[model samples]
Target: MGMEAYQAQFADHLPGGGPAWLSDLRQAAATRFSSQGLPDRKVEEWRYTNLKPVQAQLFALDAVSAGAAPPALLESSYRLVFSNGVLQSGANDLPTGVRLAGMAETLSESPGSLAAHMGQINAGQDLPLPALNQALSRDGYILSIDPGVMVERPMEVLFLSDAGTCYPRNLVLAGAGSEATVVEHYLGRGDGEYFVNAVTEIHAALGAKLRRYKIQQDAFGASHVATLAGQLGDDAHFENFDLNLGGQLVRSEIHMALAGQGAEAALNGVYLLRGKQHCDNAIQMDHVVGATNSHQDYRGILDDKAHAVFQGKITVRPDAQGIEGHQLNKTLLLSDDAEIDSKPELEILADDVKCSHGATAGELDETGLFYLRSRGIPEAEARQLLMTAFIAETVAHIGHDDVRAVMERLVGEWMAQ
Candidate 1:
C-alpha cells in the first residue's frame, strides 16, 4: 500500500493514549510525508544515492505474531529488545538507578518530560525517512541517567526485523555530571522483503559524558534508513561510532550540534559493502559556540558492484571563535565495478578558528600486495590483512574495550565471507 493508504488504515492502531497534541503531531507528520513523498535524486543532499528501491516497495505494518525470538546477544548489564517494531519487555533487564521504558510507556508515565524533547530533533524536519518515522512509529525506548550518577555497565538496544515494515524512535538523555555507554544493535532474520526506518535523539547536559555506538547488520533483502541527532552542553563530551555492514540499500545520517563552550565531540564510522549493496553516510557538525572541538572520521570497504557515498560537512558560526574542526573520509574499492563518491565540506564564518576537511578513494596498493605475497602469504589472506590494517585506525577510536573487540571480530567475519 502507498503511504496514504497505510496512514489511513493504521492511524487508530498507532500506540498512544489519545492525547490531543500527540494526535496533532502525528497527523501533521503524516500530511508532510504525503505531500513530500520520498526523497529523490533531484534533491541536492541525495543526488548521489537513488532511493527507488525503497519507493518501489509497498510497505505495511508488520504482524506482531510473525516475529521470532531475538538472537543471542553479547553480555550487557541491561538490554532492551524490539521485534518487528514492538518492545518485548518480557525479555529485558534493567540496571538500577537508570530509568528505562518504551516510548509509549514513557509518554504515559512522564508525558511532560517527553513532550519537552520528543520531536525536538526531527519535528517539522524536511528529512523524509525521519518524518515517516515520526508519523507512524510503533515502538522504541527512552533511557535517562540520573544527575551525578555513574553507570558501570553498557546498555544495549536490539532491533530485530522478521518481515514487513517497522519504524522505531528512540530518545536518550544524560543528566549533568553523569557518564554512560549505549549500543544500538540492528539485525534482520528472514528472506522476506522488508524495510526499517529508525530515528534517535540524544541530549547531554552540562558536564555529562556520553558514548554511543550503532551497529547495523540487516538482511541482504531488506532496506534500511536511519538518522541520529544530538546536542551537547557546556564542558560535556559526546562520542559516536557507526558500523554498517548489511541491507541492500542503506543510508545513515548523523547531525551533531556543539552548543556548549569547552565541549568536545567525535563522530566516526566504518562500513563494508559487497555484491549489489549500497550505503551512504552523511554527517554534519555544527559549531554554535566558541572554544569547542569537533571531528569526523569515516572509512569504507566496497567490493564487486557495491557502492558507497560519504558527505561530511562542518559549519562554524560567526561568533564561534577559537574552534578546532577536522573532517576526513577514506575508502578502498576492491573491484572494477566498485564505486564511491566522497565529498568533504567546510563552511566557516569565524575569523579565529582552525578547520580542515579532506577525502581519499582508491584501491589496494599493488606494491604492498606484492610485498605481502613475497612473504609467503596467500593472495586472499594478504588482501584481508591489508584491509584490516587500513580500517583499524578508525576502529581504535571506539571508547569501550568490549565493544571495540566485538566490532573487530565482525569485520573479520565479513572478510571471511
Candidate 2:
C-alpha cells in the first residue's frame, strides 16, 4: 500500500488530546510526514541503507494482538512497560526524587508542562521519521528528576511489539545537580513481521549527570527504527550506549548537542548480526560552545551474509574553541560474504579544537588465531575469544557495573551463535 492509503486508514485515530497548540503541532507534524514520506537512499544521511522492504510491507497502525511478556532485563529496577503502544502499570514503585508518568495522563492533566520541551529539539530540521513518530505516537513515558535529587536505583522503560507498527515517543528531563540512570529496552514476540518507529529526547541541566542505554532485540522478522536526541547544559555529563542484536533490518540514529560550556558527552555502541540481517548506526555530535568534550566509539561483529554500517560525524562551531572530540569505529567480518561500511567524519571550524576520527574493518588476525590454536584451543573457541576481546575494548567504556555485566553476557551469547 502507498503512504496515502496508510495515512487515510489511521490518521484520524492518532493519539494525544491537549490544548490547541499540541493539536496544531500534531497536525503540522502529519503534514510534514506526508510531504517527506519515507527516506530513500538518495538522501545523503541514508545513502548506504535502503528502506524498500519496510515500504513494501503493510503494517497496521495499532497492535492486532497481545505480544509475549518482556524479558527480565531490569528485574530489580523500577520499570514502566508499554505493550503495543499502551502503558502497563505493573512494577511502578519508583523511589523518592524520581517522577514518572505516561504521556496521555500528562497531556490530560498538565499539557503546558510538555509544551516547553516537546517538539523543541527538532525545530530547525525536518527529520521525517521523528516527525512521523510525533504524528502517530500513542503512548510513552516522561521522567523527571527534581533538582539536587539523587536516585540510587536505576530505571527501565521497556517496549514490546507484536505483529504490527508502534510509534512511541519518550522524554527524559534531569534537573540541575541531579543524577540518574535510565535504560530503554525494545523487544518483540513471535516470528511475525512488524515495524517499530521510536523517538526519545533527553535534557540534562547544569551540574547534572545522566546515563542512558538502549537495547534492541526484536524478533527475527522485524524492522526497527529509532532516534535519540539529547542536549547538555553547563558542566553536565551525558553518556549513552546502544546494543543491537536482533531484527531483520535495524537503523539507530543519535544526535547530541553540547549547548553549554564545559559539557561532556559520550556515545558508545555494539551490534552483532548473522545471516541476512542488516544494521546501521549513525551518530552526530555538535559542539556549540567552548570547553566542550565528546567521544564516540562503536564496534560490530558480522557473520555469514550480514551487513552493518557505522557513520560518526562531529562538528565544532567557529566560536567553540578549546573543544576536544574523538571518534573511532571498527568492525570484524567473520565470513567471506559479510560486509561493513565505516565512516568517521569531523568538521571543525574552530582554530583551537583537537579533533580526530578513524575507521577500520577487517577479519581476525591469523597470527593471533594460530597462537591460540598452539595452546590446544579449538579454532572455533579461539575465534570466539579473539572476537570477544576485540569487542570488549569498546564495551569497557560503559560505566555502570550492572549494565556492563549485562552487555558482556549479551556479547557472550552472541558469540555462542
Candidate 3:
C-alpha cells in the first residue's frame, strides 16, 4: 500500500477525536507517510531485521485507551501515560523549568520558540517508519529549558500503550548554557499488538549539556520505533542511552549534526532479546564543520531465537577538521539460533580527522568465565558481571548519578530476574 493511502486509511478512522491542531497534523502526516513507505531489507541500513511481521499485523496508528484508563503501574517509579497517543495524567505536576504541554500548545503559545524546529527533521529520507510517524502522529509534549538554567531533578516521561496502538511525537529543546536530564520510558500494559511511532527532537545550544535515557518495556506483542534527532551548537553536548527490554520488534534511528567547533555527541544502546523478538539500532552522525567529537557504542545479548541489528555511519565533511569519532558494536549469542548483524562504518573526507569503527560477534569469553569461577563466583552472576561491565563503560560517562543509578538498577533487576 502507498504511504499516503495507509495514512489516509488511518486518518479516516481516528478515535478520541481532539481539537483542530491534531486534525491538521493528521493531514500533514498522511501526506508524508504516503510519499515515504516502509523501508525494505534492501535498504543497506536495515538489512538485519525483516519487518514483514509488522506489515502482516497491520496495527492502527492511534491506540487510544479512551474509556478504559491504564491500570496502575505500581512498579514504575515515574511514568507518563499516553492512551491513543494523547498525554494522560501525571503531566500536570512536573517540576519548575520543565514544561509538558501538547504540541498544539507549544505552537500556539511558543510559536517563535518551536516553529523553527518543529517537523524540521525527516529521517524519513531513508526510513519508512519515520515518515509514517510524520504522517499519522498526533500531538505529543514539548520540554524546554531556559538558558543558563540547571534542572536538578531527573524528569521521567512514561508513554504507555493499551489495547489500541498509537502514534506519539515529542519535542525537547535545551537553551544555551543549560543543563538537564530526561528519562523517556515506553511501556505497554496489555497483550495487544500496538505500534509506537515516536520522535524526540533535541537542540543542545552552545555550552549546554543534556542527557537522554530511553527505556522500551512494552509487552511482547507490541512493536515500536523511535527517532532521536539532535542538533548541537558550538561547545554543546548531547548524550543518549537506550535500553530495549521488551517488544516483539524494535528499531531506533539516531541522527545528529554538530553545528560548531567543540561540540560532542554520544550514542549508546543495549538490547536484550529472547523468544523470537528482534531489535535494531541504526545511527548516523555528520560533522559538518571542525573540531567536533562523536562516539557510538551498541551491544546486544540474544537468547532463544532472538535477533538484533546495528548500523552506524559517522561522516566527516571536507570542511570538518580536527574531528574525533569512534564507533564499536559487540554482541553475545547465547543460543545456536540467536543472531546479530552489525555494520559500523566511517566516511572521512578530512585529512586532519581521526575516525575509526569496529564490530565483533561472539559467545561469552571462556577465560573471563573461568576467572570468575576460580574465585567461587557462580556462572550466571559471573556472566552478568562481565556483561554489565562491558556496557558500564558508556554508562560511567553519564554526569548524573541519580539517572545512572536508575538505569543500573533496571539492568541489574533484569539480570537477576
Candidate 4:
C-alpha cells in the first residue's frame, strides 16, 4: 500500500475537536508523511534497515481485544496500562508536584500546557516516521514534574499490543531541579500480526535529572518502530537504556541534544536476537553547547540466522569546547549464520573536544568457554555464563535495583531458550 492509501484509510477516522493548533499540526504532519512516504534503503540513515516488510502489509486501525495478562510489574511504582493503544487503567495516587494524564484528556483539560511542548523538538526535521505518528496517533500519555520536586518512585507505562497497528505518541517534561525515572514496557499478547509505531518527546530543564528505560518484547509476528527525541538544558542529566528482545523486524532510534553547558547524556542498550529476527539501533548525539558530555554503550547477542545493526554518531559543534563524548558497540555472534553490522562515528568540529568511538563484532571467547567447561560446568551453562558476563557491564548501568533485577531475569530466560 502507498502513503496516499494509508492517509485515505486512517486520516478521516482520527479523533477530532481538539485545539486548533493541534489540528494544524496534525494536518501538516500528514501532508509531510504523504509527500515523503516510508523511507527506503537508498536513504543513508536507513541503509542498514529495510522497511519493505512494513509497507507490504495493510494494517487495520482497530486492534483485536486480547485481554492477556501483563508482564511482571515493579514492586512499588505508579503504573499506567494501555491495550491496543487505548488506556485501560491509570494511577490516581500521584504524589504532589507531579501531574499525569492521558493525551486526549490533557488536550481537553489543559490544551495550553500540551500545546507548549507537543511539536517543539522535531518540528522542522524531514523525519517521515515521526511525522506519520504525529499525524495518526490518537492516544498516549503526558507526564510533567514541577520544579524542584523529587519523585522517589518510578512511573511505568505499559503497552500491550495484540493485532493491527497503533501509533502512540508520548511526552515527558521535567522541570528545573526535578528528578524522576520513567519506564516503558512493550509486550505482545497473542500470535497475531501487528505494528507498533511509537514516538516519545522529552524535555529536561536546568539542573533536572531524568532516567528513561524501555523494554521491547513484542510477539514473533510483530513489527515495532519507535523514535525517542530529547533536549537537555544547562546542567541537566539524561540517561536512556533499551532492552530489545522480540519482534520480527525492529528499529529503535534515539536522538539527544545537549543544548546547554554542563549537560550530560548517557545511552546504553542490550539486544538478544535469535531465529530470523532483525533488530536495528540508530543513535545520534549532538553537543550544541560547550562543556557537554555524552556516552554510548551497546551490546548484542545473536544466534541462528538473526541479524542486527548498530549505527551511532556523536557530533560536537565548532564552538563546543571542553566536550567529552565516547561511543562503543560490541556484538557476540553465537552461530555461524548470525550476522552483525556495527558502525560508530564521531564528527568533531571543535578544537578542544575529547571524542572517540569504537565497534567490535566477533564470536564468544573460546578460551573463556573452555576454562568454564574445565570447572565441570556443562557446555551450555558455560555459554550462558559467558553471555551473561558479556552484558553485565551495560546492565550495571541501570540506576534502579528493581528494574536491573528484572533485566537479569529476562536475560536468564532468554539464555535458557
Candidate 5:
C-alpha cells in the first residue's frame, strides 16, 4: 500500500543477467524511488493531481496471460503490439533505414546500444513515477532512424492492458536530416482495475523532423500515468499531440528542451472527461539556445462531475535570444458540477525573447449554440456541433491524415456518449 510494497517487489521484477550499466541504472533508480517515494500534493509539479488512489492499492507486477486483442491496426502502418507490458507481435517488414526492436531482446543481445539514449533526457529529475518506471520496466521498444532517410509509413505501438500493473519504458532516436511519424495507442481490454506507469525518451538530431501522437483509451477502472521527455538539436522539429478519452485517473506529462539553435517544438492535446473521470496535463518547454520556437495548445471538455487540470510553462534562458514561445489552454465545462484548473506560465530571462501564455475556462458559447439550433438542429445536436468546432482547431495541427481522421472519429464517439 506504500513505497515499501513496491520496494518489496523490486528484486522479483528486475530483469536478471543484463549488462552491468543497465543493472546499475536500475539500482540507482530504485534507490532514488525509495528516497522520494510517491509524490503527494506537497510536490509543486503534482500539486493539482493526487496519487493516493494509486498508492492505496498493491498491483501485481506481472499478469498470468494476455487480455483481449488490441484495436485494428492502422492502414499501411508498421505495427508493434504489447499486451500487459509484454511484446505480443512485431512488424516483419520494416523500412530500410529504420530499426525497431523490443527492449528486452535488445538488452540481451546488444545491451550497450542503449547506454547513450536511455535516461539521458530525464537525468537529474526528482520525479518518482519515472524513477519507478526505470527500475521496474521490463518490455518496450527502441526505434532508431538513420541519417538522411525518410520513413514512408507511420510506426504504431499499441499497449494493451487488462489487469495488474506494468511499467513500460520506450526510447526514440531520430538521426540528422531524417523524418518519421510515430503513434502510441494505449487501450484497456476489460472493466478491470489496473495501473500503467510509462516513460518515453526522445532525441532528435540536427535537421530531423519527428511527429508523435498518443491516444489514451484506458478502461474506466484503470489509472494511467505517463511522461514523455524529448530533446531537440539544431534545426530539428518535434511535434506531439495527445487525445485522452478514458481512464478513471490519468496524468500525462511532457518535458521538452530546445538545446540547439533553430529548433522547434509543438505540444497539442485534447481531453474529453465525463462521469467523474479526472485528467491532468503537465507540460514544460525550455529554450536553451537562440532562435528556438515552442508552442503549447490544449483544450478540454468536461461533463458530469469530471475534473481536468492543465499546467504549462515556458522558460527562455538568458542566452536564448530571438526565442518565440506561446502557450494557450481552454476548457469548456458542460455541467455546473464539472471543474477545471489551468495555469500558464512564462519565465523569460532574455530581454530579446517573445514569450506569452494564456488560459481560459468557461462554458460553451450560447450564441453559437443558439445559431446552430436556429438552423433547425436539435439542442443536443447543436451542443455537439459547437463542442466539435471548439476541439477542431487544436486537432488541425496533426500532420498525418489517417491519425487525424482516427482522432476525429474518436472525438465524435466520445461526444455521442
Candidate 6:
C-alpha cells in the first residue's frame, strides 16, 4: 500500500480517544511525520545508520492490549509487562514506594509531577524517533519513587511484541535520596519483520542512585531504535549498560545532562553483531555545572558483513568550571567486509577543566591469536577467546555480579554464532 494508506491505518488504530493533550499530540504528529518524511542519510546525526531499513517498508501500528494473556513470570525476577505499547500493572510485581501503570493514569493522578519531566530532557531536532513516539504513542508505563524510599527489587520493563509493529513509551521518575534499578528487555519470536520504536525519559533527584540495563534480541528481520534522556542532580549517580546481540538494525541514543555540581554519569555499552546486521551507539553528555564528572566507554565486535558505529560528544559549558570528563570507544572487526566507525569529540569552554576523548577501530591482535593456536587451541576457539577478552574490559565495571555475568554470556553467545 501507499504512505497515505499506512498513515490512515495508524491513525485509525488510536483507541477511539480521550484527553485534549492526546488529540492534540496525534494531530501534531501526523503533520510532523508528513513534513519530516522519515529522515534520511542526509542528516548528520544519522549519516551512518541509514533509516531506509524501516522507511522502505510499511509498518502497521499494533493495537493496545494492556492486559493481554497474563505476562509470564520468568525466573529472572521482578518485572512490568508492556504489550503493544500499553502498560499493564496487574501483570507486574511493583516494589513498594512506587506506582507502575499507564502514563495516562499517572497523569490523571498527578499532572503536575507527570508533565514536569515528560519530553523535557529528550527534546531536540536531532532525535527523530523520540519525536515520532511522542507524537503517535499516548500510553506507557510510569514509575514514580517517593522521596527517601529505597526500593529493594530491580524493576524490569519487559516489552513483548505480539504482532507486526510495536511502540513502547516509558517514563521514569526517581525522587530525592531514592535508589532503584531498571532492566529493559525487548524479546519475542524472531519471525515477523517489524519495528520496535521506544523512548524512555528519566529524572534523577538529589542523592538518587539508579542502575539501568538494556537487553535487545528481537526477530532477525526486525529493526529497533531507543532514546534515553537522563537529568542528574547534586550527588546523583546514573549507571547504564546496553547489550545489543540481535536486531537486523538497531540504534541507541543517550542524551544526558550532568545538571548539578558533584553529580556523576557513566555510559557503558557492548554490541556484538554478525552476518549482515547493523548497530550504532550515540552518546552525548553535557557538563552543565561546575565540578561535575562524566565518563563513557563502549566496545563493539563485528564479523561477516556486519557493521558497527560509535559517535560520542562531551560538551563543557563556558561557566562549567573544574569539569572532569573522559570518553573511550573501541571496535574489533573480524572480516574484510565487516566495518566499524568511531567518532569522539570534545568541546571545552572552561579554562580549569580537564576533558579528553579517544576512539579506535581495529582487528584482534594476530600475534595473540597465533600464540593461542600454537598452544594447541583450535583456530575458532582462539578467535572466540580473544573476542571475549576484548569486550570484558567494559563488562568488568558492572557492580552487580549477576547482571555482569548475563552480559558476558550474551557476548559469548553472539560470537559463537
CA shift of 391, model 6, Å: 0.7
Give the TM-score comparing model 4 with the true structure, all chains together: 0.97
- The sequence of per-residue lDDT tens digits that candidate 1 reaches over residues 1-417 is 466775664465454554667767777777777677788899988988887877655356744743665654457547778887788752244555578778877777656667677668632256777777878885687889888878878888888886878888998899999999888888888655688889898889999999999999889988888888888899889999999999988999988888899888999999999999999998888999999999888999999999999998899999899999998899999999999999888899999999988889889998999999999999999999999988999999999998898899999999989
The better candidate by TM-score, 2 or 3, is: 2
Residues 1-417, model 6: lDDT tens digits = 344754665576554345565556556655556556676879877889988868743346645452343343234556667666556543255666787677766666665555456666744323557766766665677778888888776666777664556656777888899988777877756355678888888889999988888888766688888888888999899999988887888889888999988899989988888888899998889998988999888988888999888989899999999999989888888889999888888888888898878888898899999999999999999999999999888888775666777677777777787
Cα-based lDDT at residue 89, candidate 5: 84
Q: In model 2, which range of ten residues has the least summed lDDT?
A: 56-65
Question: Which pairs of residues collide in model 2?
Answer: none
Tens digits of per-residue lDDT for model 4 on 207-299?
Answer: 999999999999989999999999999999999999999899999999899998999999999999999999999999999999999999999
Per-residue alpha-carbon lDDT of candidate 2 for residues 145-223, written as tens digits (9 for 90 to 100): 9889888777888888776788888888999999988888888787668888888999899989999998888888999
Off by over 4 Å in 1: 1-18, 56-59, 65-73, 90-93, 122-124
lDDT of each: 0.84, 0.85, 0.76, 0.88, 0.88, 0.77
Clashing pairs in 4: none
Which model is ahead, 2 or 4, in terms of TM-score?
A: 4
Better of 3 and 4 by lDDT: 4
TM-score of 6: 0.90
Instruction: Judge candidate 3 at residue 79 and give its lDDT.
Output: 43
Candidate 3: deviation at residue 255, Å?
0.7
Give the TM-score of each candidate: 0.94, 0.95, 0.89, 0.97, 0.97, 0.90
lDDT of 5: 0.88
Candidate 1 vs candidate 3: which has greater TM-score? 1
